[model samples]
Target: MDYFFAVVAPLAVVIIGGCTVRSVKIISEENEALVERLGKFHRKLESGLNFINPILDTVVLEDTLSERVLELKPSQAITKDNVSLIIDAVLYWRVIELELAYYKVQDIEEALRKLVLTTLRSEIGEMDLQKTFYSRKDINKAMLRELDDVTDRWGVKVTRVEVQEITPTPKVIEAMELKRAAEFKKQADILEAEGTVRAMELLSTAIKSQSNSKDILQFLVAQRYVEANQKLSESPNAKIVFMGSEPLGSSMGELLNNSTISPPESNGSNSKSK
Candidate 1:
């Protein structure tokens, strides 16, 4: 009887000790785990101390409930207008249902990456190159909507999406620059022509508003003469020749007549004489 008691006591101690180690579960804060009993989901273990039938229970998965960020790789896509562009994006998501997340998807991150890329290309294909740059926010919204729709079944929620970068091809950028320069040059030409027209209109109005247009015309010609001489003086290779002293109005008028640009004044006619 003494030998029987000694042997049974050691076996009982071993059995109790093994059960204690297997049944005890201590999960950290912000962490969760799924327990499966007999090859089927039984319950979820929350943070803190937990007890389980270790003989029939297994901790299937343990992960944090923290938000995660997934940055997508850059990819090339063509716009509706057939312009090629490189695009990259980021996704913010978190697991809300661990069971479905593990059961429904073979690989979570890879699945999300493919889905995001497909949605991105689909959205981009609907817009032109210019609209892509102008409507970045619209693209992000559409991507989030599409991603959420499909990812909902995976037990994850996409909180937000951001289109980080969009770049056109080098050839397209060069073409855009050239097109912009041409537009600027065209506007400058139009402004210059308008300015010339305005100046001519003002000169006509000034001349017609005066009682004696000939006096104003003579003054204008004299002003032009002095300006021409001033510009010529500034040139290093200019040759300024002076003729015999004569009234500027007479000399300039004769020069205009000789050049057939305008009729000259007659000196032989007296005042009020036809």
Candidate 2:
């Protein structure tokens, strides 16, 4: 009888002590614990030592309260222009309410990833291929807003969404490059034509202001001759033609003569004075 009491008493004390210790849980600063009594939610366990009924209470869920990052796989989507593209993205989220996070969603990360992908596709579908490249901010903002609304019920806060990469097919890329080059060339041609028109307008004004059109005509003819000679000199086998300026000189003389021809009234006044 004495031996039985000594052995059984120590065993009972050890078992009871272990149960008493388990009644208190030590939760880390970055973590939260959910307590359920008889399969029903009783209270939440925050960071530090928490005391609860060992026999009646159970710690069902323990989740980290820190921010989490999720890198999404490349997903294929179509733009409003019907161009297909591959998009990659990243999401930032955190659990604000441990109980809701555990009970409201079966899989938080999976749900968040799918939400981000669907939202991305929807936003991309509303934009053209060109706009997708530059409208990343708008897309991110829209995704964050939509995700926050849905995830709020799950006690998940969507902090941010980032578009990592957008890749069009090889053929689409080539076509885009060609289109950009053509646009640049078109702008260059427009600027060149505008410069030519402006030059012509200025020349016309200068020619009208000058009394002796012969000087301006000679300068223009000489400049053209120099430019033509220079261009011909660039080729080794080029033939240089030295044409006379007599045709240009005769045309200028005729123009000057026509301008100097006075009215009949001025001619009659001069004749009467003489």
Candidate 3:
């Protein structure tokens, strides 16, 4: 009987000591724990020393208060224009309610990831390829709004959603580049034509406003001839030849005489006539 009593007393003391030590839990400042009694939710254990029945209560779920980042794998989605694109994103979230985070959703992170992917696909499907590139902020805001609303019940707050990369297929990218080039060329041509029209209008106005149109016309001809010679001189392959300016002079005289403005008679010819 003495041997039996000694053995049972030591075993009981050891069990009680173990239970006492286990009942006192020290939680970190940034962490939370979900306590359950007999597999049923009892209460949430906050940061610092928390006590619970060692046999009956268990800390089933433990999570951090710090932000968590989840990087999504690249997902393929089609734009409104039917252009296929691959997009990947990163999500920033934190557990707001430990009980709902554990009890409401079996896997909060996975559910949040799927929600983001679905929302992203839907948003991308609504926009054209060009708009998708420019409207990234709008898309992110929309995703955050939707995610916050849906994830609220799960006790997860989605702080931010960032689209890491949006890549169109190689073929689509090539096509887009070509299309942009064509559009740029078209705009350049239009601008050139508009400038030419404006220049012509200004020249016509200046010519009409002149009192001596013949003098203005002669000046314009000489300026153009000088410009042409300058361009020919600058050309690497151009062959410069010394040509007589007599023909040009005669053509200018003829053009001046045919003009509506009468040329002033020379003083020498007038004195000789007098």
Candidate 4:
């Protein structure tokens, strides 16, 4: 009985070793494999232990179903304003239907890349440089929606689309900065003029209410004159001029009174005159 048991044990070990080496497969978690029987689709080998007919079944492809990131290179695009920009993006995607992904597209990665680039350029061409900067989220959502529609048939689920960078050309950047500075300067000048007008109105009201208004006005004018001299003294080639505070105050009051705008004549009066 011992001799028979020893012979059978050796034969069993050989058979088990051969099966383990050739037929058995361990598919990792989150991974899948496709098998073909005589060059025809047989079955999908899912995660965990799987056995295949060593002679007939062959693994055609193995891939993971996990989410993946595809980073796009900076592509040059012209905005609606004809401003050239360099933009890059990232795509979060995953294969929902492995069979469709493998058979439908010859090269899935290349197809997705081209599709994304085309969509990005199309969206960018619809917006100006300023809109492109402000509407970043809108562009991302639009791309995601557009890509999802097209890639649905390709078994790709684009989870998220992100615009990583949108940068204008160096010359465009400099021009934009200059334009912004001009806008700021114009705003400042308008505010300063409005403030001066408001101050003159307040001074006119004070003069009407008080008897010593002339003395107060002359003192204010002298203070402004000193401030102007101090600012001019900081300049490399400043020419200082001295003038009496009383004359300066009188002239300032006359200038303020003359700053009012005359209203246009009534249309009825003009017609009657004609």
**lDDT of every predicted structure (CA atoms):** 0.87, 0.88, 0.89, 0.87
Q: List the candidate 1 regions with Cα displacement exceeding 4 Å.
A: 178-274
| Least accurate 10 contiguous residues by lDDT in model 4 | 256-265
Worst 10 residues of 2 by lDDT: 259-268
Query: lDDT for model 3, on a 0 to 1 scale?
Result: 0.89
Task: Give candidate 1's TM-score.
Answer: 0.65
Question: What order do you get sorting by lDDT, best first?
Answer: 3, 2, 4, 1
Query: Candidate 4: misplaced stretches above 4 Å?
Result: 1-20, 178-274
Question: Candidate 1: which pairs clash?
Answer: none
Compared with the true structure, what per-residue lDDT tens digits does model 4 show for residues 138-191? 999999999999999998899999999999988888998999999999999999
Model 2: per-residue lDDT, tens digit, 1-274?
A: 9999899999999989989998989999999999999999999999999999999999998889999999999989999999989999999999998888899989989999998999999999999988998999999999999998899999999998999999997777898899999999999999999999999888876776676655676688678877887888899998877667787678767776666422224345654553
Q: Model 2: what TM-score?
A: 0.64
Clashes of 1: 0
Q: Would you estimate the TM-scores of all the predictions?
A: 0.65, 0.64, 0.64, 0.61
Q: Candidate 4 overall Cα lDDT vs. reference? A: 0.87
What's the C-alpha lDDT at position 44 in model 4? 88
What's the true lDDT of residue 199 in model 1?
100
Better of 2 and 4 by lDDT: 2
| Model 3, span 1-274: residue lDDT tens | 9999899999999999999999999899999998999989999889999899999999887779899999999999999999999999999999889899888888888898899999999999999988988889999999998888899998889999999888998888899899999999999999999999999878767777766776788888888888888888998998997455678879888977876654444577656553
Candidate 2 at 234: error in angstroms? 25
Colliding pairs, model 3: none
